[model samples]
Target: MIDQSLIDLWHGFGVAFQFHNLMWSFFGVLVGNLIGVLPGMGAMSAMSMLLPLTYVMNPVSAILMLAGIFYGSQYGGAIGAILLNLPCHPPHAVTCIDGYPLTKRGKGGTALGITMISSFFAASVGIIVMIFASPLLVQIAFKFGPAELFSIMLVGLIAGGTMSRGAPIKGVSMTVLGLILGMVGTDVNSGVQRFTFGFPDLADNLEIVALALGLFGVAEFLLNVNRMGAVGSNMKLGMKDMRPSRAELKTAFWPMVRGTLMGMLFGAMPGTGPTITTFLSYSVEKKISKNPRSFGTGNIAGVAAPEAASHSKTQVDFIPTMSLGIPGDPVMALILGALLIQGIQPGPQLITEHADIFWGLIASFWIGNILLIILNVPLIGVWVKMLRVPYKYLFPLAMVFICVGVFTTQNSLFRVGEVAVFGILGAILLLLKFPVSPILLGYVLGPMLEENFRRALLISDGSLQVFVATPISATFIGISCLLILLQLLFWLRNLMRARKVRESAGVPT
Candidate 1:
């Protein structure tokens, strides 16, 4: 199977290596890097902006470019986080902990170098996993009925809550809120409006583009503005400072490998995203490190681990999205949407029917990673300098691009307004110290969860026991239960420890 897949992938490379495909891929990397360097611009916004242009190109070339944009920006995102203390995307947030400190210590170039090397290594591993594991994963995907899917989605939601930095209750509430917001549009099953509030445009549904822009872009802009007064004014990178020392590389090497493995596992799981992968990788590295106290400082391992995991997950995310048509994230959903528009159905038959696309996409991952390594490292100085651009000038341009992109999606101003509203909501959530990632996760997965849960209920005639009847579903439920129990125990132990500390201090418990 591996050899056959490689042969098919080579056939795909034959197509992807063409002049037009290569050019688009380059264009995508360029655009993605620009967006990634700029604060607040995410992959979804970048993809949404480019979605229309794809109609004019060959579907294969277009998809290759889009895929490049998706992961290429990841390389750039680390630059912004490390140099500017501004994370362009959510997953890049973890990099800020150590990356920015490295920059502050005049090692911005070194941080960028380690980030590039680690990302490339992790991406290579992830792409290999995608190529080999997809077939088996697809077969298992086929066995999932609606109930099983719903169960999986529930597990994802719960996992997101458990992963939160704040109160689990708050995370759960936010997820529920996201679900309620997701339900606001017209119901597909009954064709009845749920929460449109008499708005004709909204009767169709809230556009994910608008929401994502508002949440990530607009909200991020506001937050940046709030901190503008204290932000660093200079962005400079010396050539000598950019290169990592032999010791730095030696330290980061194993951590990168560990992060790559962790990312591959998590990314292959449905509904998990790079944010979780990065956080988990960072925590794991810290736990196992000889100098764990240096984690949040300027530790090179801190930068390498999360950055590698974040990039690796991009490759792994395609596994479920391509094979089962179950989008692991919003970006995957957009890719899946593009596949559908091209008249290519995603599932088990996808590999057999469109071998070229499957193999081409897989091969392109390898090509794109090579391109990113080539383009990003030498240009690290240029990207580091991007932080010098004033937020006042940069943010307005970003908003313009965002508005134009949102408007262009459907040629509607209402959609642009929707983006603004969501942006405000995102800002408020950020101010309240609430996590925004779960909201998007919930919104993206909510409808699917509902559809699957209903389908399972119908199949079982409303008897819930069917969930336990299937071996796969039973296993999923069992794992979910165990995870919940473990988390509960951890929480209780922490609470008891806190009470004991307070008692020791002679404070009221």
Candidate 2:
């Protein structure tokens, strides 16, 4: 079956490589890279902006262009994150932890190269996984009841929560806060108004672009303003500085392999996103490192691992979106929306009914990744030059982009106002030493968790025991419980160790 599918995929390349689709893929990738270079304009926004333009084209061609935009932006996002301490996209926020440090250490170019190499390798591996794993995953997805889905989401949330670097309490707090924010809109089943506070603009849900811009983009700029001189002094820009030695590449290779596996698995899971997977990849890298304490200060594995996971995750997100019609996150949601607009429904029947569309899109991932590598290597020096720009002048421009991008998202000034609201909130959280990533993870997963839970209850006639009745659901719940228990044990063990040290030092007892 896999062999036949590979043959079909080869046929897909034949279709994708047609003159028209090929041209659109190249053009789309170029445009997406430009969009990624500009902070706050995520791939979803870029695809949304381009959705109407695709209406005039054929379905396969349209999809080719949009997919190009999404995966191409993977590399472009790293540029802003490393060079300016700006994530430019949510997944890249994970990159900022070590990527910015590397940039500060005058290894911006080398960091960018690792991002490119790891991304290329990971994306290649992701495509291979998609080719082989889609059939298997979709089969399992068919067996997944709402309870199983809910249980999986629970573990995902817990895994994300425990991965925080600072106080675990702060991470959990932010995640809970994100869940509250996710509840701000009207309920889908009951049609009841939620925490909207009478604001009609939130009748659907909070805008992702607005939240991301304010939390990561605007808040980051505000924090940087006071430290402009220090930021400027740290960046060393040149071609030579970008190259890494044999040791660095060798160290990052195995981490990249591990990160790719994580990305392929999590990225294919419904409701999961690259941001979470990147965080998980970073967590895994730190966990396995011989010198774990060196992670945040500037570790190449830190840069390679998360970047690899994020890039691969972006591509594999298409697996469920294309195979089961289950979107992993908002970007996949938009991609799904685009297919619906094209009068195509993606599901188990997708490959059988629309073989060309399915295969063509798969083949396009390869082309887009290649084009991105070709574009990215040469653009490293140019991206590094951006660091030399004075923050005093650059930040105001960033604010303008944030405002404009938010407004364009919904054609509402109200959404722009939401940026200020979240910006202040994010700034406060940053000052309080809270982990902001959990907030995002919470916000993204909260809706899915609720939807799945309700669906499960409805299917089981409101019986609470239904969650444990099914084998898959029971397995997931059991795993989630075990994971939480293990984390608790670790936390308690650390607490006792700290207490012992304090007692010995006579500081406190």
Candidate 3:
């Protein structure tokens, strides 16, 4: 099987590793980095903008280029989070805790270097796991029924809430809001409008591209503009102040290893992504540290851990998406959609029938990860210099690209307006300090959750006990309960400690 797969992969490589394919991949990485450095522009938006170009290219090369961008953005997001206090995307949020401090302490080069190195190592691990585990994973996927899928989704929702920063209630509320937003289109079962409100276009429901771009990109631009004067006055780093010391490298090493393992495990699960992996990694590191008090105060481990996890998960997310045809996140879903469009079916037979695609895609991940490391290391100084560019001038150009990109999607002005509306909503959410990552996760998983849930119920004749009766479903729910209970216990312990501290200080409880 391995020998035959390699032979087919080499044939696919003839298409994916061509001069044109290499050029496209390079172009994709460059563009992806730029978008990643800019706050609010994520991989999804970048892919959406570039989707039209797919029409003119071969399917294999198109996917190769898109894959380059996908991983490249993970590399680029670290740059912004380190230099500025701003995160380019949700997964990079943890980077801001330590990355910005490193830059402020004049070690921006060190932070970028460690991130690059860790990303390469973690990505390589993820790819190797993919190569070895794909066959077994495909076999196991055959055992998942509707009840198992529904239970998995339930675990995802609960885990998402528990992993958030604030009250789980707030996180749960945001997820509920996302579910409502997801339900805005025509009812698939009844063929009647659900929340279209008399508009024909809306009957199809909200476009993912429009919602994502508006919420993250447009809203971020507005928020930045409001703080433009303050941002403009900050000093840019000189090249001499950028490099890290051997001590910093030693400090970052273990955290990177821990984060990579954490990310790989979570990323293998369907409906999870780098955003959750990063958060979980950071929280775990903070909990286990000898000097937990220094976590948000320029800890090098803080920067390295999340950066490693974020990029590592990007590679590992393919495990479930490829073998099970169950997306680990929104971007994977889009890739799955692309596969379906090309008449390539996904699931167990996918590896058997499309060995070339599977192996070549795995190979390209290694290539792309190496390229990102090579490209990002030398460009830290260049990225830091971009901070010197005024937002007044920069934002308008971003808006222009956004407008042109949205218009090109469906060649409709209405979509542009939709983007603007979402942008406002995104801006408001940012101001309110509501987490945006869960909302995206919610939107991506909502429809699938509802569909699987109903199917499971129908099969069981509305018996909820079926969820507990299935072994896989029972295991997942059990794990979910344990996680929630553990979180609650931790919270209560923290509260008790706080009260003790207050009492010792002679303050009222």
Give the best candidate by TM-score: 2
Candidate 1's residue-wise lDDT over 1-509, tens digit each?
A: 77887787789889878888888888888888877776556677789888888777788888888898999889877877787655667677668768877876767788988998898899888888887787665555467777776776676666655444467777677778778877887787788998888898988778766776577667767877744432334445665666678999999999999999878766766765676677667766765677766865699998999888887888888888877788877788998888887878988788789877777888888888888878876776676665556777767776786777677667799998998888889899979988665676567567777877788888889999988888878887887797688778878998999999999999986
Q: Ten residues in a row with the worst lDDT in model 3?
A: 227-236
Q: lDDT tens digits, residues 110-178, model 3? A: 777788778888888887667666666445555677788777767666665544445666767777877
Clashes of each: 2, 0, 0
Best by lDDT: 2
Write model 2 residue lDDT over 431-465, tens digit each, in one string.
Answer: 88887777777887788889999999999899999
C-alpha lDDT (0 to 100) for residue 107 of candidate 2: 81
Candidate 2 yields a Cα-based lDDT of: 0.81
Candidate 3 CA-lDDT value: 0.73
Q: 2 or 3, which is superior by lDDT?
A: 2
Q: Order of all candidates by lDDT, from best down to worst?
A: 2, 1, 3
Name every residue pair that clashes in candidate 3: none
The deviation in Å at residue 424 for candidate 2 is 2.0
Higher lDDT: candidate 1 or 2?
Answer: 2
- Candidate 2 regions with alpha-carbon error over 4 angstroms: 228-234, 286-295, 345-354, 506-508
